[model samples]
Target: MDLFNSAQGKNISFVRPAYFIIGGFIGMAHVKFYFVFLFFVYVVSVLGNTIVMLVIYLDHNLRTPKYIAVFNLAFVDLFGNSALVPKILDTFLFNHHSISYNDCLTYMFFCYTCLSMQALNLVALAYDRLVAILFPLHYMVKVTHRFMLTMICSFWAFIIIAVLIAVGLITRLSFCKSVLINSYFCDHGQVYRLACNDYFPNDMVSYMYPVFIFWLPLAFILISYLYICGTLAKVATVQEGLKAFKTCIGHLSLVAIYFIPLLIVFTLMEKIHPNARIINLSLTSIFPPMLNPIIYVLQTQEIKESVKRLLKMDRKLQLKRIAIM
Candidate 1:
């Protein structure tokens, strides 16, 4: 927080965020508003995910394997946003692609790597559903708490490997010729465009790895969920099906909202649709952090009731403390 508040850091952040708030994402008018918005997201996302963790930790009934998986998902989103959003905000709000070479490399690699953790998280969640529905008894033993820890560790380690591979490839090349980057932030794909030396390996890793690692996992998860959906269709009891449907709906909504805009924005970047960039960025960066908490509140009965009761209890406690004073 102190870093962001520093006069220098604050100055650097001002140049990056115009892609969304003022609707000139490509025009590069004011990155300051964008960083302000990102700071807001960081606080809210951290708090929102923490609330989910607290609600689950406080409530014994929420200790089921399913909600446990949800806790992991929340954790992933929290850290993922933390890693990427703030740095991007700084690039604009601070400098016009003015990041120190080392800082840019570190920031870009780690941010994307952290975001890749989400790929594995969703896959893990999908498998959780598959086992729960098709083989409940086995799901318990297979998706045990220890097993969850292993998944988390392995996923992060692999993410590091991917980052190293991409960055190692890029840093080996030269970029002294044309330092000015066109993108609002320094995505390596856009960075490659500006590099003066050969970037064939960088290009290959950039082009292929996102597909092999992130997209492949996402596709598998979608396929698994499709089968899960079909199985859900066969539930003999309407009440049982509705219960399952409600739980999954919140996550599915998040996936759609996150993925669609990303596909359109990144895919169409070369085509140069400023409106799409603005819309896509707002949906991708802003909504998920702020609105996802609302998703959990509406979807999970335990959380909704807990929040309501928490609010009531807090009010009473305040009033009683006031009377005594």
Candidate 2:
């Protein structure tokens, strides 16, 4: 009460309690084990994405179009995880579940922005591969560094505008209920459901924006693959066709890993309990970033060889150290 009053005196438009209690799997069984599992996922997501960025930075051969998209995806994942996972850890480990109304909005904005950027990055990746497999001879000319830079800049601009619009709309709605957000992080859906004013516009944007941001990119990816498959079918030899198709194997795996859980979770959202919903949401959010680097590391021969070479150098350095000692 004191905190809320003081904040109100200072012109802060906060909920009476001044914080929203995040329903981060409250009353779930074996919560410690859940914390341990989520902690491991957080570590893997951060470390794996870091390694992806570092590997792409250190290897000159990976400075091309496809790896550039991969690098951008890793970067977005790292930022998104940084924004979301720490709050989750705090909630589970330290019982700090109260988030201020303003902070909640900020977090939601960043999460959506990263999500939008990731979808755009996937589209860029699909286009990159489409050009490579469909027009191998002109891939370099068509997908130049300058072109990629322009695309990246344009994407950031578009997402910033979109996020600002959504946030602006959300901030206008009034909330007078108990400030309890029924999710791990501040989901926009959960937050806006507490609004006391007209919320139909917010609902419309919430549901419709996803179609443009998520489904459109998905459609583009499918079309790109269709063209890629057609082109591969026309290749001279079976081995050549296989080689071309193999290049997309990692991407296909990544897309499946990222999207399938989300689809299932969305489909079953109403059927599941709140705790189950939080667990499902948290897993679907974190797992893709954690496994993305692993998929690339395992599936791409170039990255595997790079890792092996790095290991060999470490071994040679160890031998030199022993000799010196």
Candidate 3:
């Protein structure tokens, strides 16, 4: 790592943490397979999420404040998947295992920042649905465009500050030697473990910070769901209850895919094999982005109809251009 120049103009070389070793199971064949599989994942995820965001943008009917939260969630998935999967493809397919210290930090910052933002977006989505169903009369007043914009802005600002603080603490530590990070990407947990100084404070901040940052939003989502469920149970008809449940299915599936494997890895982090841990991380990171739009298209009739209508219009426009030519 290049820290600074001395008064004597000597380029002082710091003990720069060099290449991080990304864990993979088995031989060269596995690398090729991973490359193909993950490339497909990245392409499909980006395309799907882009379509979701575009439909929400183009359609006047879907311009409610709740869809604003939904659009932000799509943006989060696009951002996170873009940050992570291409690097994995490079690492596996081209044997580019080495990531610079600066690149690693950039990767970690975006990954965590997006993850934090996604959690908050889900929390907002849950609250939106809760308001719509539980108190339909006040839903418009409670979840206004102004309110959604404020929440989205606040979430991004908070994650930026939190990541900057953590990275600031990381920069203060002295690394005595080139350290090998045990994962594919420069995860804060993987990188911070390489510091030579007193790691107690870093560990404390790392472990304690997430409970409030991640779990608090998660808890709010859970409470919102609980109230939604309880309120549905009291509805006069089973069809009404089912209709209410249908509204939440997309968000519920997204939360399940995003968090369940992550919870499993968190529970078994210390005990799992390095390859297993890497696999879990990759799946949890990549799967949600890939599945999110699919979930909405499948579960939400409005989005499905909107997508079909858009595609039909696109086909018609293409034919008209062909006729003119």
Candidate 4:
């Protein structure tokens, strides 16, 4: 990959940023087989997200605003993973590391933007649940189709604008320094660190998205869920309280799964150790897409059970109609 330096008459690389690849001077196969491990993880992710989307899309029981929100989450995860994982696999497996300026820009833009939007979606979903539970009488009106659509549009618009500004600054940068990315793919921090010019503006704009995308949403979600829990407590029925608590557990588990790794990955990138960087980064990008669906289904027994019941009903009706005919 240093050939780019000679061909373009510029230098870029950080003294073989593969410290974490084969174990970072540590004898762990986790670093040695990172590519194979990631391949299995990505396959499960694609299948899991695809199954959620397909089940939700084809099943009438899943057409509600709740699962539509989930469908959106799954779609975002699928696309974001698709954008990065394939390229990553290519790099690690086939030794195809060179990327065009435009390809790099597109990859970075979508992956980063989708992550922002996904976190926002979860935050919004938390609010949706609060509205559905605490103010049951007004759930339909509050989470109406038109309002959901508007929120979706607004969220995308705001996030895309933020990402565009960051990415635009990146494109204007002269990469007169190292081209080697210390991570698996084109991460914003790694790229921003490579620019040879004034990186103050870049730093100000670079990766500041986590504050907006993660911390803000995380705070909102935590508060909303707390409210949800408090309100659920006041209800008179034990069965009802238990049921609601079960649902909350599912959402909380998922919230932890999504946010914990995210915070860890961004924070750990500060370390000069490549092993910490690779492990954290890989889990942040890979695990959420793979595990989010399982959490959604397992946590909310009603949704998956509803899907199953609806399928059974359809099969019975079809058989009955055929017999009558």
Top TM-score: which candidate number? 2
Please give each candidate's TM-score: 0.77, 0.90, 0.89, 0.84
Lowest lDDT 10-mer window, candidate 2? 1-10
TM-score (C-alpha) between model 1 and the true structure: 0.77
Q: Which parts of model 4 are misplaced by more than 4 Å? A: 1-32, 235-238, 266-272, 310-325
Candidate 2 has what TM-score? 0.90
Q: What is the lDDT of residue 306 in candidate 3?
A: 84
List, in order, the clash count of every candidate structure.
Answer: 13, 0, 0, 5
Regions of candidate 1 where Cα sits further than 4 Å from its true position: 1-26, 29-40, 58-64, 94-97, 235-239, 266-270, 274-283, 305-325
| lDDT to native, each model | 0.66, 0.81, 0.80, 0.74
User: Who is ahead in lDDT, 2 or 3?
Assistant: 2
Candidate 4 on 1-325: residue-level lDDT in tens? 3333322324643222221121111333545377777778789889888878888878776777777678888998888888877777776666676666667777789888887787887876787788988888999988987777677778889999999988887765666546666667667777778766677878887547667888889999988978877887777487887776676676677688889877766666566367666767667777788888777777677668866876898899999999999
Per-residue accuracy of model 3 over 236-309 as CA lDDT, tens digit each: 37899898788999989988887778778988889997787877787888888889988987889888888888
lDDT of 1 at 307: 76
User: Per-residue CA lDDT of candidate 2, range 1-325, in tens?
Assistant: 4333232355645433466778767778888787788788889989999988988888787888778788899999889888877778888678888878678779888988886787788788788889888888998899998888788878889988888888888766667766778788888888778876678988988898878787788888989999888877876478998988898898888888777777788778789887887888788787788888889898989888877777787899999999999
For residue 276, model 1's alpha carbon misses the true position, in angstroms, by 4.4
lDDT of 1 by residue, 148-254 (tens): 76776787788788878887776565444445554445467666655555778888888787786657887987897888778778863778777776667766776
The candidate, 2 or 4, that scores higher on lDDT is 2
Ranking by TM-score: 2, 3, 4, 1
